[model samples]
Target: MPSPAAPPPPVVTPFTGQFGLAYPIICAPMFLVSSASLVIRAGNAGGMGAFPALNYRPLERIREAIRQIREESAAPFAINIIMQKSNRDRYRHLELALEEEIPLIITSLGHPGEAIRLAHQGKCRVYCDVVGLDHARKVADLGADGLVAVSYGAGGHAGTLTPFALIPLLARHFPLPVVAAGGIVDGAGLAAALCLGASAAYMGTRFIASCEAEVTSTYKAAVVAAGCHDIVNTDRVDGYPGNFIRTPALDALGLEPSLVERILSGSRTARRSLARIRATRVLFGAGSSRATYKTVFSAGQCAGLIDDIPSVQQIIEETIRHYHAIKGTLP
Candidate 1:
């Protein structure tokens, strides 16, 4: 994509206006990839950036990271909280977010009822990540401010529907703003998403290759070199189906969990314990096993669209330029 010769046109929508973003993009939160610097850069660049609360361990780091971003930049940023029963710290994470008066909270994997209530009380907004209309309706009914339609080809645990199908479905059924997530990486994608009734584009895979991402260079290279075919869905990583690049490290993990592993994963409690074990291995580990775990990087099929490692600002600016250029040619 070429750089813009002139200033990009305003692409503001209700989502961007409400979130104080100049661009209709959200750097979707990733488990290990999203960092404070990435969030700050994305926000300062006129797009919202987020990181999972679990990314910072010991809990206090979450507060510190929030404060660090607040001190350094005035851009809007979000903290993701996995509301599943397994995330024992979800309450505390949400508590701290509300206590700090964070602007937005992204909830995933569980009902966001409590999060919505508390966040609204704290004068913040809650956006639930939904893969289908069923979940979208539920969250909307729960008074969620917006919906993040996580369509197929998304990096993490994605839904089965495509953005074309999911985005319109939610927009038609709910009055709230919808942010389309999935295989959106460029201005064409951002333009198409808005045309499909999305207020913003929720991007993850593209940013994984950004200079701000903290992943290993090998992981970044894999993302840059990969195509749609190189991306595969695997449940062995953490007992949930998430798309990942098929690297030698991912191949070594095997195709699926063992029989006993499968049975244990069937239980919520066991799944939680297993997730903690995986988190431990990934975040702080020593030995070859740890090295292998580190390679289990999550990415979307949109990795095929990303060829270069650019700064977060460059990505946003180029995307906005592309979007304007495309919008100009539209009928």
Candidate 2:
């Protein structure tokens, strides 16, 4: 008998068909930085861009901002509902997204029961940022459409799991989409995420310094200037450990290694130890990179990967090209 016909190749559908994207890149909902304009721009570029809802604490502004995004872009956008108990007030912000019928919602700092329920009601998609395999399981079980696997060296209050370890574990257990976040800055970085089985890549620090971002020029300059070893993975006082560039702020606190250990161990709350995080923001509003200097500015160790300050569009294009180039290497 003739050899059996070779089995037809499995279909390779574009990832965007499900997520509704032109690209698999996402602009991370950075705290105090992601603007409605910026969010829409990313979406228009064939990807998702997000804003932290807390930035619009005032209900009226929140509604207005949501309306602006709806009016300005038909592309999909997201709002970040912080997952911290301390940010209970942010729940009201979550209500704004639901009320406006936002399409994409990213839950961070906590469980997604509320976000998932709200999104399902609106026929929206929900994603969550997680630090490890356990949180990944929780996000998936809670009915998120996707999980942003935040691994070691992620900016801000992030987790310690390595991307190599976290991605495969999630790929094996979760059927939903996985977006890798952590120390990813270039096109090569984007390629690696896809190769590792992530459906997308979420970025923050690189965009934080962009002209489209709301932070000061001085802060943007600092991001361009810093090198990798300058960063510190500190848990000195924040309830969760996060990465930041070491600066005078950390040194001035005079924290002993033992004290750092206590905070990281969860025996002591950062509320008592690092009471200055809030006060220091006063400096941020005042445009003093000085206070944030020698102090931890929430940045990933990938600072080494970033050099010149580029527009968000430029970063997106460069990364997209690299993603495709890497795909070409797969065969």
Q: Which candidate ranks first by TM-score, i.e. highest?
A: 1
TM for candidate 1 is: 0.90
lDDT of 2 by residue, 1-331 (tens): 8995432222122346665677777888876678897887777666778888877756688788888887888888888887555565657867777878777788887567887877787867888887777778777887888878888888776777889888777877888788888888877787777778888888888887776877777667767777888777765534356677666676654445565545654744555334334333322343333333224467888876788887777777777766666667876
lDDT of 1 by residue, 57-170 (tens): 889999889888988789888899989865778899999999988888999987799999999887789999998878888898899999999888899888899888999999
Worst 10 residues of 2 by lDDT: 5-14
Cα-based lDDT for every prediction: 0.86, 0.72
Model 1 has an lDDT value of 0.86
- How close is every model to the real structure, measured as TM-score? 0.90, 0.84
Extract clashing residue pairs from model 1.
none
Position 1, candidate 2: lDDT: 85
